[model samples]
Target chain A: MIQLIAYLIIIVLTIIFLIKMIPRKLKKSPPYTCGEPMKFEKPETVFYRTLSNILGLKKLQKLSTGNLNDYLLMIFICFMLLLIVLVMV
Target chain B: MLAPYAVPLLICTAFALPVFKNEKLIKAIAILAIFLSLSFVLSSSIEVFNSGTKVFAVSGFKAPFGIVMVLDKFSSTVASLILFLSLMIAAFSSKLVKERVKEFYTLLLLGIVGSLGIVITGDIFNMFVFTEIMNIATYALIGFTAKKEGLEASFKYLIIGSVSAVLMLLAISLLYSHVGTLNMADIISRIDTNDIYLKTIFIMLILSFCVKIAVFPFYVWKPDVISGSLEPVAAFFIGVMTTTTVYVIIRIFYTILGIYYSTWFSIIAIVTMIVGSFLALLQKDIKRILAYGSISQLGYIFLAFSTGLAFQGMYHLVNNAIIEVLLFLSIGTMLMHKKMMEKISMYAFLLGALSLIGIPPLSAFFSKFFIITGLLEKNLFIYAIISGLISIVTLLYYMKIYFMLKQGEKKIYWPIIILIIAVLLLSFVPVWLQIFKGVEVDLLARNEYVSEVLRP
Candidate 1:
């Protein structure tokens, strides 16, 4: 039981560290498009606009995702959970 | 007495890197180190074959308290293959790796040492440490090019590999907690007494090994990383790395856990075989296709072992390693041609593809036949049919690659002819099965592995 708690704490701390390391200024960038700039966009609404653009919910949006480390991490977490269940069973 | 040769040779080669001013001297050192290691492997294999088993207690400490190196038929055979393939890859690396030549050889030798340690050591903690060393060296080797794709692939591998390592460590901890001994033989002696905790630890260990073997769902990183690395490095990684891991898995399952619970294992093996083959048939990139083919082949080996066919599994492992090395060597040679990308050599590709698909008279066919026979002996008729169907799918995928390559018109190189002959000679050699026959032939009834290891 104590070991399980320790594992949970480590996981939480790692996730917190990842989130805190994100750059605030970079997160506030204007909405990005593939070829053209937005002319009738509200500057105050840039965060949502950029989020939509990155998620491909906006016109001419190019979702340029970089590495796949995050996805691998998620799959690894899933496997670990599966292992824990298999052991506990 | 000669057991320390592996570490010292690696250290000497690493230290003498700066003194060698000429490229020829560096190449000579690389070849010398590998040749000496190969000789050690050969001598040790012969000793094991004659005397049955030889154990080296490091610094003269007793079992369960100190590190032990056991040279049995199983370890010696796998070790010999590792050394021989490393020699061939080192020769190939001389021409292949121009950038960071010294560092390449250093890491390559270190990786070889780690793998050898994993094969020979009887202590579980030492196995974990050796596995880490091997993983770190291989991760660096994969990212040696430092290109964007290489870095990305390495990062992906690093993340997945770390999780696997953690799982393995956790499994070790569980075992230690239960058995109170890290020695494999000691653990085996105590395994039958424990009930619930033993099953928990067993499941954990199997899960960790599944990650290492990349069975079915745990295999996503292999294709990406293998395709992204350089040709010779890719060849070495496939030829040696995966085989050693699978060998260790076999050791753990058969020698440590015993085969009383083989029914559970058989189910897992069948799933991995079917799924891996289906995925292999859908791949497009040549290297990715080969990577998937290797996973499927490993599945067949697992199936053979789960049905209490240790000799057949070992034979399949040896044959698969030889075929993969020859195939990758041919691919590496073809990749060196100036116009290779413009018009890929059809003959070279066809030979590689045919060898992978278990074509008649090839090394793969013999191993595949052994596995099918084992399955039939166990009365696994449905699995036998599934295995046959997947074998056809494997042939179809490989034939597609061959036909696509053969569609182009280009003069075949001399190296391709050499590779063809090497593959043919390997297929003709009955050395592995002969060794199996010489030893206790019926591995199904009672495994001779532990007895062989403790013989001396």
Candidate 2:
């Protein structure tokens, strides 16, 4: 329905605004203790850093580091998505 | 009809300020803009009182046809309280934002604008829009600290907030599909109480609001979000923003849906009170303690609403806002703004703490009395008794906060002193101007709200 799609559009726009507009440039930080940190010690590839900056994907920095809380977030989102799919179907 | 520029004036000022980019001027502008907003709100509230409900029908469309902003007493009262607390926050926090001054005030104003919109709008979709605006602004502000804990807390809020938003949209879609209207009054007029989807929509809407207010089983974000942010921001979150959500939920039940599902609501309220009290007792941090206490106060307000004493519930709402604002503002100053903090006297600190704990001769106690009285009047003796026991637990934790401060040298300042005087006078002055009496009773003026918004 148009109403359903309209709702999704509004929520998606909000998500984009959250990711792209807010959360200022990530400052320099110590490298991860684990091995996932890309060896950009010489500071190559501005595009990757830009991607990291805009999306705040701490993929490399947060490698092998985690919290129970993050796991809980995972579970919550999964459960909610399941419910939404069920209702929609 | 008062023009609806009051909300937009704030939004326009916020968006226009980035070019100037001066910190002092930004603070001045935020404060002045909030002050003007408050002036318009109070004056407009007077007009609403004299006339009927004030409707700002956008684009020359009326009622069910357009984005309508309706200011009844209930909405205006909450809106004005939000603006009042916002002004205090702006003035209190001006000296605090050394970095990101413009962004801070801009987000703060935008958040206020959202809250005002939430309180005023008659359309469910507009309510969703306002709620998201408030939540997003809150997300960015919570992230302002840039510390991992702050961001983590903010992200937690984002996830949960996003879930609530989706639920809100789904609920609105359900309502629209059922009745083909987004206007709250129109939906109410067309609501088929016997239909099963009505119950589903009700539950969904209640769930969405519960997440925002951090009710039981969904309050995981409250402790982190309240403790991680700066103290006044925490105060604003717990005091004003939570009040807005609860107010909307309460209004939905009272004004629109007409209490077909009140028993379910009562269950939620009772559980939130007891759980929130018990959790507050477990917390060591003052912010976390206040956060949990905020939940407990919300439970009391909910209890009042379930008993069909929305007026009493609103009294407690306004009263709780004052108590939380005083507690958090003083505690925040003590923790963060020590340099600018003037030493608060025991009279002020003890009054705020005792008021929160619901001691006699304070407005907080009186509001609780009204709620308890309402519960008892409805013959919900069990609920009244349990609520009483929770009050004891509440006093225990609030006293814990009081004793925690005793070990340190205490500090109270002019703002707190003024608040202390205001609290005492608000309760002590027993004339017609009793702050609780006017709005407490009128919050149940359903006919006025229904007629003004629907058939105006």
Candidate 3:
């Protein structure tokens, strides 16, 4: 237990030392493509767009069009399907 | 005895709010009323733990013949949780809700009354009535801002909720026709699961509740609804409204129908989880993302229930509710004071997001761990894997929000601070708490529940 405690203290001290002593550089620069600065799409937007495309989420979102008629239609379809499935079961 | 007082107390307070012109006085009265109701709920829960189920037959009429409020271990525990969360929301909303103070408090108290009524009632018809009251209050609350988007979301939810309510009422009528009683226990005793009519009734009821709890295909309204509402109201929806609906679904399936697992339901749960996670990934707005995350979490709870992991499901439900409330209320605070976002609020938000992602030593992590382990025990390795993968996706969206709000000043928001502390303390629940003791057994002990409710 003593050894474990000593190890934990050492780890804590190392973290504190690293945080306090590290020379930090904070600056903003445009992305470099070859020798020129290039405009880049935000990574978050790119990631989400890629994910949405790969998952066919646009199709799903289209189905959830926030239309009252569409929602009612979906519920009706679900209800009918449930009835059919349960009757078969 | 105290169990029955929550609904009446809140209802009376709601009506009394309109009489007071002083906004501070109205807020004080509303908070005091909910505080009193919460105290009563806790006291009643203690009584239930010390003894057993307490059944109050309304107006001296016996069960099956009149309205009854059955306060059992399950009901009392859920009711206490609901009131506790409501109290938190009420306190937070004191500053959050600015316009139409009387209307807001009145509607909020009425909504609480409806929620408590749903939790405690023994009659299925009465449950339906309470649900309507809750839904109506929610519709007005969702559109309280009177913005275009808010009104649109409210109108949409109104249409869906009305249709689902009709389906539920139809199911109840069919059930009454077949069993000749509206009392849940009585219906359980007479229910013939093998019969086609009975099966139809069960499906209708489940489908309606599926919509109410925002399961997939029926869940599209939830994100829009949450995004449209004021943040505190959104917190109420995520924390109390959905949680109570989940309780109602569990009560009906576990207690009334005595059906523990269903393949179709599990399929729907899996779909709901996948859909919610993917949709959440595509969202830029914090509220919409959390809303979709909530839908995904509901899928987890439903999947656990589908596999007969009652304790794990309930644990996840409670943890998810806490984390969502923390996140929403924190975001709400930031929105309320946009120029003065606080470090404590940001830390609280991050903690909630991490917990929702099932990070180590957090309350949600344990619940997710139990759920995964429970699934493994049931030999559902694929479902367990799916749940874990979705947790990663949950992390992705919440991290997106984290990056957006990485900077804030050092200050304290009391409600978020309290919730953060609560989230930390809940991590100890698995090891030290007996709060959920016998709850799982009680859920499965339909025979005991029925006998007690039907006893002479």
Candidate 4:
């Protein structure tokens, strides 16, 4: 029991020391980018755009433009392709 | 018997709605009428589940001669779901829709009629008629605001819907000429699966339904349509309209055509999942993100369907519908009452978003688990993996919406709260009801469906 109490005391002291060691004040500095501040992009934009490029989704996205004629053309092309595949199968 | 009556009741209520000028009276009557319609559907669905399939033949004429409504396990369940969502929409819209209250409820009921008719009707040509009715009503509802964007979206949808209708009628006529009958059961027995013309008809029919259901290349209209409309109307379109069209596709492919598997269909489903997720990742608008999310979710359903996992597909469909309605309505509530009940509204939206992401202790997770297991059973390891990865992407996009929520509330709490409870209860369905196994068996029992409709 004495040993256990001693260990608990040690754990509490360690946690207190760690908490006190954290800097309460710090110097602020602008990020260095060859003496020019970097332009910031939304994390969502960066992550998704990078992923989208990797997946070649730009072409698909391009086709999804809200133009009615584009939608019709794409539907027609897909329909014809489906018909061909069905006939072959 | 009660199933067929829902359409007329809704139509009658729709016609009667315009006569009343008082907004409160209009809202009361609309809610009462939809409540009645829901009760009728619920009772008939219970009858189907308890006894067996019920056939309601019009004018005492039998199959292959006159129109009939077949209330089998599948159709009854889907019909019940459609009406239930309509009721929730009616209740939610009562508080949100103040301007043109009469016209709004009237169009809403009319849309319900179209969807209910599509689900219950057992004739192929009747299905075509109901599809058109649903399409016209949907176009009007999308343009209900009469805003520039809304009108443009409505016009685009109208054009696409018209072309699809033409394709559907052409296919149906060709089918009738070939089979000499419009009754689904009769046609099922008469169809020669090997015929070339039958293949053409199948492709054409699928293309038409694809437009309605908003499959991959055809899904461009949905986000625009959803973004342009009022939030509750968008909820109705996303939750009720798209799902009803999916039910039609399932009925046609499984019951009528007897097609249980197709490689090309599964490929299209996978592509739809990939494209929808990628596009959703790119969207900044909350509604558009949800619109694309629904498209991705539908792909999951189609994947399950194409892989012979109809039960799992349907389970997911129910989960997706509830989640979508909850999310859309919560957002609508937040926007309408910005200061009143922001805390509860935010929590509701968070719960809905989590459910959509398929987090554990939520309904979608179980349905998605079933679907993945089903794919594994069929040795579709790649498709299973893809679906799992897409869920992660789903989480990412949903987080975007979560980050966007500001605050809001009031009066619409009951509907959203009821929906939240429904979503929670659905996770326990397999444990409590033990109904899914029976439903799965019934779906595979194509011969039973045919016999029920044809029995004199």
Top model number, TM-score: 3
Put down candidate 1 lDDT per residue, B55-86, tens digits, no spaces. Answer: 78788786767778877667777888887777
CAPRI docking class of candidate 4: incorrect
lDDT, candidate 2, at B131:
93
Local error of candidate 3 at residue B211 (angstroms)? 1.1
Query: How accurately is candidate 1 docked according to DockQ?
Result: 0.08
Clashing pairs for model 4 are: B341-B408, B342-B408
- What shift in Å separates residue B200 of candidate 3 from its native position after superposition? 0.2
Residue A85 accuracy (lDDT) in model 3: 84
Cα displacement (Å) at residue B62, model 3: 1.3
The lowest-lDDT stretch of 10 consecutive residues in candidate 1 chain B is: B438-447
User: Which pairs in model 1 have colliding backbones?
Assistant: none
User: Cα miss at B336, model 4 (Å)?
Assistant: 0.8
Q: Best lDDT goes to which candidate?
A: 3
Q: Candidate 1 docking category?
A: incorrect
Provide the TM-score for each candidate, comma-separated: 0.80, 0.81, 0.92, 0.91
Off by over 4 Å in 3: A1-37, B431-433
Error of 1 at B14 (Å): 3.1
Worst 10 residues of 3 chain B by lDDT: B429-438
Tens-place lDDT per residue, model 1, A1-89, is 43235334433543453344333443344565786654543332443345345644322111112336544654566467756765554
Candidate that beats the other on lDDT, 1 or 4, i.e. the better one:
4
* Higher-ranked by TM-score: 1 or 4: 4
